[model samples]
Target: MKFFRLIICLSIICGVGSSTYAQKNFAKEADHAFFNESYFSAIEAYKKADVKAKPAEKARINYQIGECYRLMVDPAQAETFYAKAIKLKYASTNPDVLFRMADVLKQQGNYKEAQDYYEQFLSKKPGVAEAEAGLESCKKAQVWKAEPTKHIVQNEIQLNTESYDYAPAWGDKKHETLIFSSSRPGSTGDGIDDRTGESYMDLWITTRDNKGKWGEPQILPETINTEDNEGGAYMNRKGDALYFTRCPREKKTNIGCDIFYSEPQGRSWKEATKIVLKPEGADSLSCGHPTLDRKEDYMIFASDLPGGQGGKDLWITEWDKSEKKWGTPKNLGPKINTSGDEMFPHLTDEGVLYFSSNGHVGMGGLDIFRAEETGEMQWGNVENLRYPINSSEHDYGIIFEKNSDDKRGFFTSSRPEGKGRDDLYSFNLPEIKFILEVYVKNKETQEPLAGVEITLVGSDGSQVVKTTDEEGKFIYDENGSDRYIKKETSYNIEVSKDEFLGAKSKFSTVGEENSKKYIEELFMQPASKDVVIDFPEVQYAYDKHELLVDDRINSEDSLDYLYQTLVDNPTIVIELQAHTDCRGSDKYNKALSQRRAQSCVDYLISKGIPADRMVPAGYGETTPRAPGLECETIENMATNEEKEVAHQKNRRTQFRVLSFDYKPSGSGGE
Candidate 1:
C-alpha cells in the first residue's frame, strides 16, 4: 500500500555489514531494526554503532540518521545530519545522496541551497523526474516569496486540538455545518495508525451558528466509525449521503484502505457499504480521497494501483446513475498525475479542479495545484496556488463553502504553528468587489419592467445611473470587465420608471468578509394618489420627542431614497406622514405624531431639499394598523408581545408624492 511505501523505502536503504561478535554487531543490529521499520530503535543503535565503526561505516551511519530524521519530519535535524554525511564524503559520489540533501534543504526553507544541489543532481543524472521537480520547486518558491497572493489563511483554533484534525468539507445546506477528519482523543477507535502515530482517524462534525460561532465537535455515529481508521469524508450536495475512506486493521498492520459510503437513516447513519472501484478485490493497494464534480456524474480518487504514472495517481470513474454502478477507472494522465503522489482532489462548483501534488514542483511537501478542464478528461493550465497557501509542509484537501464563488474555503495542512500534527485552516482572498445584479418588475402585475432607470448613490459620493434591459435586468459586471460596486462601501439604490413610484433600498458590503454576488429583485409601483412607500420601521425611545442621532443612521435608507427621488424629480412636492401606536391617549399621541413628522421634514431640510416642496402630516392612534383597536383596550387585553407587534405596525413613517407641479424659482412655468 502507498501508506507503507515510505517505511519500506527506509527499510531497504543503508545496507548492513556482516560481522562476528559474542555481542552482536551494533551496526548489524541497527540495520536489522531499520529493516523491521523500528526507526527510533534504529537511530539509537546507529549512534552506538557509529563510535565503534570505521570512518566509512561512521559516514554511512550518519546518512542513515538523516533519513530517519527526514521520515520523522524533523527537517532541521535531517539537514544537519545530511550535511555531516556529505562533509565526511560518505556516499558522496551517489546522486541519491545529493537528491536527499536537496529534498531536506527545500523542506527546511533553504531554497537557494536546495536549488544548487538539485541542479547538480540533475546534471549528474539527467531526466530524473524528482530532481527536475525539486529544481522547479526552488525557482517557484523564490518567485512566490517575492510576489504572493492576498489570501488570508487563519487557523480554526476553536475546532482544533492537540492532534491531527483536517480534511474539512461542508456537511449541510447552509454551508455552516462542517465535517472533517480527526485523529484526536475521543475517537471511536482504540488502535493507532503506525503511519501517523495517533489514534485511528474518524469522522467528526461541528456547526456554525447564525452568529458565525462554531460549536463543539462531535464524533460520527458508530455505524460509520469502527475499531479501524476511517476518515477523508465528503457529503453529497443534499448532505444525506456520506463517502469516506476506511482502513481496517489486520493483525498488526493496516489492510489497504478502500472508499465506503453511508446513507443517513433518521439521526444515525446506515451501515457503510464499500464502493467497489475494481472487480479485483482491493488489489493489496490503497484508494482514498474521493471527490465529485457538481453534477456528481464523475468521481475522482487517489489510488496506487498498477498501470499508473507514479506513486499514487488520481483516477476518475463515471457514476452509472441508472445501473447504480461505477464505470471503468481512467487515469488523469501525465498532465496531472506525476511520479510523486497527487492526492486530495477537490472540484469546485465553478468547474475548476484543485488537488495536492508532490509530483509537481512546490515549496515543499504536497503543494496545492488547480487545473481547468480543456476537454473531456483533459485538464490543462495546471497552476500552483502558491504561498502562503503552500508552505514547507504538507497542505492539501481543500473544500469551499457551497456557493462562496472561490473566495473562501477550508483546507487541511500540516504547516508549523498548527494546533496539532495536521490542522484545518480557513483561507480567503482579501481583495473582493461587491457584485449587484438587479431585476426590475411591476409591483401590481408582477411582470418584468423594462427601460427602468436604476440609480445608485454610493457612500463615497459616487453615483451611476443605468437602464434596465428588455429583460428587466442589469448585471453590474455584465461583460466581466468592469466593476461598479466596492468593498466596505454602502450604496442607496433607486429603481423608477417615468410613471411609477420609485423603489429604494440600501445595499451594504461594509462588514462582509466574503466576496459574493448579490442578486436583488426590485419592484416599482405605478405613480398614483393611492401609492405609498414605506422604508424600514424606525423606533423611538419612549416619551422622547427629539429624534436621536442614532435614529438618523437608521433612517439613511429612507433619507437617501428621498434625497435621490428629489434629485430625480426636481419639480415634485411630497408630504411626510407619521403615525403612532395605540399606547398613548389620542390627544398626546396626535401631538407626538405631529412632532415626529416635523422631525422628518427637518431632516430633509437639513439635506438641502427646498422647504417649500415638503409638508408634514400626523395620524394619531385613530388610524392604527388595527383600525378598531384602541390604545386603552389593547393595553388592558393584549399580551405584551402582541401589543408590541400592534404598536410596531402602527408606529411607522411613510411618504407620498403630493404633487409634481412644483417648479424651481428660475425655471419656466409648468
Candidate 2:
C-alpha cells in the first residue's frame, strides 16, 4: 500500500509541475518579445500570460501590454492599462509609468495636470536627465506666453492632416516645388515596422501650381527612397544637388543615419551617395539637418560623433570646391549646443538661426529657439520662441515661407488635435516698426525752415509721399519705407517755397543710418547785380581754341556769382582776352584764340551783358613771359615733362577793369 501511494504522489507532482513550467516559459517569451521592440508579438504573448499569471505578475504583464500599445500609438488603450497597473500597485509606480501618464495628459491638452505629474516624477528620480528636463519644461509651460491673437493670421497652405509636415526648404526663391519627409501612406515600401507594424518613413514631393496652389504630395523616386527612413532634405539653390538623411536598419555601423547627396538629371535624381567626412576608424555618426549659407561655401548641421560636449551638437563644415568635399566639422560650442540635443537648424535670409533644444528652458519637450548668427560659425544667446508658437509638447522645424506676402513662416508641432504625432502650422511674424524723420533749415542761418514742401521719391522715380508735419516727419509702411533709405537706391527729395530758392537734393539711401531721416538746408541768398565771370586758365589742344561744352561756364554758383558782381560794380567796363601756348603758328593761334575769346563774350552777352562794354581780343603766342623763347621740340627741352608743363602755363584767360569811371548818358556826358 505505501509503494502504491508514493508512486501516485510522484505522478501527480510531475503532471502539475510540467503544466507550471510551460506557463513560465510562455511568460519569459512575452517579456523577451517586448524588450526586443516586437510590440505586436509582445502584445499577443502578454495576453496569453495575463490569464494564468500571479496577481503581482499579472500587473507587470498588463504594464508591458500598455507599453506595447503606447509604442503602437494606441494611446487610448495604453492609458487604460497604465491606469490598471497603477491601481494594482505593480512596479507601475516607476518613473517610466509617470512619464507615460504625463504624455497622455499632454495628448489630451491637460498641460497643467501633465506638468504636475512630470514634476513629481522628476522629484522622485532626480538623476534621470530626460525626466528632469521634462519637469523643468512643464514648469516653463505654466508661465509661457501665448502668441497674441490679433497679430497672427493662419496662412493658406493647410496640411492634409495635422501630421508632422515640417522642415520645409526650397531650392530657389520661387518655392514652386518643395521636398519634405512624411510618414503618410503610399510610401515607396510597404514593410511593417518591427516596433509598431507601421509603414516606414519616406521622403515626399509636393509642387505648387502657377497659381501658387499646392498639389497632392507624392512619394520620392525609388532611387532616393528605400525601406528605411529618409528625412531632413535640403537642395542647393540651383536645385541640381540634393542632400538628405537616411537611416538604415542597422544602427551600430557608425554610418547610422548619415547624410547622402545626389545630383538631378533632367527630371530624376541620380543615384544617391554618402557624404564621408570622418577620418579612418572614427564613427561617421549622425550628420543631418544641413543648412547651406547663401554663398554655399559653408554648412551647419547636427551630429553626435565623438568630441562633442554631450549628446548631439550643432556643427559647421566648410565646403571645399576644389576637393569637392566638406572639411573637418567644427563643433558649434556651448552657445548653441547644450548637454541635450540641439537639432533642426533653419537660417533666415537675414542670418537669424532657429533650432530646437531641450537644454534651454522651454514650454515642453524640445522647444523651438532662435539665435542670431552673431559671428562666423558662432551664434548669439538662444531665445525661446514664446507661447502658442511652442507648447507643452515638442515644437520644431521652423521655416520662413519663400515669397510670403505676410512675412509668415512654417513650423511643426505635436500638439493635440493634430492628425498624428506631429503637424505643420503656418504663422505670420509681427509687423516690424520703423520711423522716418526729415529736418529742413535755411542754408545760411541753419534755422529750421517751415512751410517748405518736401517730397520723398521712390526707386521707380514715383513720389512715395509728401511731408508736411510740423516736425517735418513722415511715416511709411515697410514695403514703401525700405525703398526710401535702402542702399543701392537713389531718392530725389525736392524742397520748394515761394521766396526760398527751389532746391533738389539727391541722396543715396545706401549706407544711410536706420531712421531713413534726411536733413537738407537750402540757402536763399539775396539776388544781386550783373558781373563778369572769371574762369580759371583752361588749356586746349595745340592750335585748337574751340570751347568744349564742359569748358563753358554753366554752374549755378558761377552764374549767381557773375550776376552778383555785375550788380555790385555797375559802372565798370571789362575786356575779355585769350592766350595760347607758344607751339602753334601765330596766325592759327591768333585765329583760334580770337574765336575762344569771342565765345566767352557771346556767353556774357547772352547773360544780359552789354556787348559794347565787354570787348573781346586774342594775343596769340606773342605774350609769352620769356619773349622770343619758344619750345621747338618736346625732346630738345630740359625734361620733356617740364616742356609740357611750360607749354600749359602759356594757355590762359585774363580780365582787366578797362575803365571804372563812367558818366550817365541819360543826364550829361562828362
Candidate 3:
C-alpha cells in the first residue's frame, strides 16, 4: 500500500471487496482485494486475471493493476501499467487513468510530460481544481528544483535497508538516539503485508556512537512492536513517553489503525495502551501519526473520521487533567487540512506544525508543509518546505531539533535517490548570503557617475549609507558581522550626488529561496538648478487642465520622476513650470499653463509628496527658444512640419530646482 494510505492506518471498508463478483475467479479476487485496500495482493491477482481475460476484460485488468500500484506508491510500476492501460483505451470505466499517470509522472519529477498529461486530463474534465493545481505545481517544481533552498539533505545510508526504512524521530534531548519505523528483514511479522507486499512495519531503535555513526538496528520489545503493523513514532519532551501508530493485522477485517503510547521502563516499555481518538466502536476510521507539544497538553494526529474537511485531517485533542482523558478531538481547521489526505504530523516544541499533504499544491505525491499557530489553537500561513526537503515523492514525518533557532532535522522520503524505498534523511540549511551590487550612472550621457551617495533604508528600520567607487559601483553585502540584506524584508534605495537629481528604487528579498547577488543600476539625471528632463510621452486633453490617462500615454504617471526626486532629495524644492504654444492668446495661454502646472502639483501631493516643495510657474509663450524658429518670425521656418515641431517644443513642461536648503518640518538634511 502507498505510505499515504498506511499512515492513515491501512483504512478501507472491510467487506466491500467481498461483495463484488466477476466473470473469472482471479478477476473477482483482484477486485475484492482492491476494494479491501490490499493493493499489493490486488496487483498479483489482476495479473493472473489478465492471462485468461478477453480483450476488454484484459484492458480492465491492466487498469486495475495500475490502480493497485498507484495506491501502493510504486510510481514507476504504476506509470508503466497506466501507460499500457491508456494504450488499451480502458478509459471509459477508468476516467482517472490520465490523471493518475500524470500524478505518477509528476511524482518522479517528469514535469514537462506530466504537464501535457494534466492538460489532457483537463481537456476531458474541465475546471477540476486538482488538475489545475497539479499543472501549476509542475510549473513551480521545475523552478524550485533549479534554485533550491539552502537546506542540505543527505540520505541516512547507515540506518537504511533495501526495504522501507523511514519516519525517524529523535529519541534523546542530546539528539544521539533515533527511534524510527521500518519494514526491513528483522521484522517480527511472519506474513507479508497484503497492502505493501513487505513485512509489517515495526518500531526500531538505533543509537549514535561517540563517532556520531548510527549503531545497529534493534527492535523494540513486545510492549511496542507487535506482530502487526507498527507505524510512525515520536517522543515526548522528556523522552520517556513514546507514541507510535499500530495497525493490528486481522484477516479481512476493517480494524483501522490507532496510536499507542508506551513509557520506558528498564529494558522494556510499560504495557502499550491505545490513545482513543475516535468515538465508540469507530474501528473503520484510522487515527495515527501522533505528535505532541512541549508541555504535552495536547496531541495532534492524522485521522479520516467524520467531521473532517475531507480524507484525513490533522486533529487536536487536549489532555483533560481532571478527567484523565483526552478532550473531544477538534479538527485543525481547513487551513491546515484539505480534501486530499493529510498525514504524518510532527510538531516542534515551539508549536510549529509540519505535515504532508497531496491536497495542497505540491511537486508530487506528498510534499511536506509547514504551518504556524496564529492564536490559541489556531494555525495559518501554510507554507511548503519545497524542493530538496519535499521532492516529487512521498516526504512526511519530519522531526526538528526540539527546535526554535535550530532549523536542521531528520525527515522521510521515498525519492529515487534514497537507499531504500522510503529512507530517513538529515537536512540542515546553510547560511544564506545576499549581496546587493548597485551602479550609479549619468542619465543623459550613459556614463558611470562616481561619488554618488547610496542610502539604503530597510523595513526593519535600519538605515545605511555608502558611496559609489571610481567604477560607480556600491556593494552592500554586510555591515561587519551582520548582512545588510536579509530575508523577508523590503529595502528602499536612494541615490544622490551634488550635481545629479536624486533617484529612488526598491528591492525586496521576500520569498527568495536561494542566496543571490542582486545587481541594480540607477541612472541619475545631472541637475544643479536649471536642467530640462523629458517625460515619457505625456498626452493631455485640449485646453483643459486634467492630464490624459490611457494605455499609450499617462500624463500623471509621467510626473513620477519628479515625485521620486522630491522623495529622495528631501531637502530640495523645485518649480513645476508649464508652457503654451504661441497660437493662443497670451492671457489664455498663461491661465491654461498655470492650471496645468497646479495639476502636476496636485498629482504629486496624491503620491504623498508635500505641496510646499513644488511651486507652479507658468511661462506661457513669452520665452520661446531660438531666434529663427519663433512664430513671431514665422517666415524664417522652412516647412509647416518644421514649424509645428518648434511649436510643440514651445508647449512643453519642465522642472528646475529652486533651492537645496528647503527642508521639510521635523527633518534633518542639507
Q: Can you give the TM-score per candidate against the true fold?
A: 0.62, 0.56, 0.66
Stretches of candidate 3 off by over 4 Å are: 2-4, 12-24, 402-406, 433-670
lDDT (C-alpha) at residue 324 in model 2: 86
In each prediction, how many residue pairs overlap at the backbone (N, C-alpha, C within less than 3 A)? 0, 10, 2
lDDT of 1: 0.77
Positional deviation of residue 155's Cα in model 1 after best superposition, in angstroms: 1.2
The best-first sequence of candidates by TM-score reads 3, 1, 2
lDDT of 2 by residue, 539-645 (tens): 44445655543545433333344444444455556667687777668898898888877876676677776676667788787776454335554336777778877
**Residue-wise C-alpha lDDT for candidate 1, range 73-101, written one tens digit per residue:** 66677788888888888645655777888
After superposition of all CA atoms, the RMSD between model 3 and the true structure is 10.5
> How big is the positional error of residue 189 in model 3, measured in Å on the Cα after superposition?
2.1
Worst 10 residues of 1 by lDDT: 6-15
Q: What lDDT score belongs to each candidate, Candidate 1 first?
A: 0.77, 0.63, 0.83
**Position 645, candidate 1: lDDT:** 71
Specify the highest-TM-score model's number.
Answer: 3
Candidate 2: segments with Cα more than 4 A from true spot:
1-52, 58-82, 90-93, 103-109, 126-132, 145-166, 250-255, 277-285, 320-323, 403-406, 430-670
Q: Comparing 1 and 3 by lDDT, which wins?
A: 3
Q: Which candidate would rank higher by lDDT, 1 or 2?
A: 1
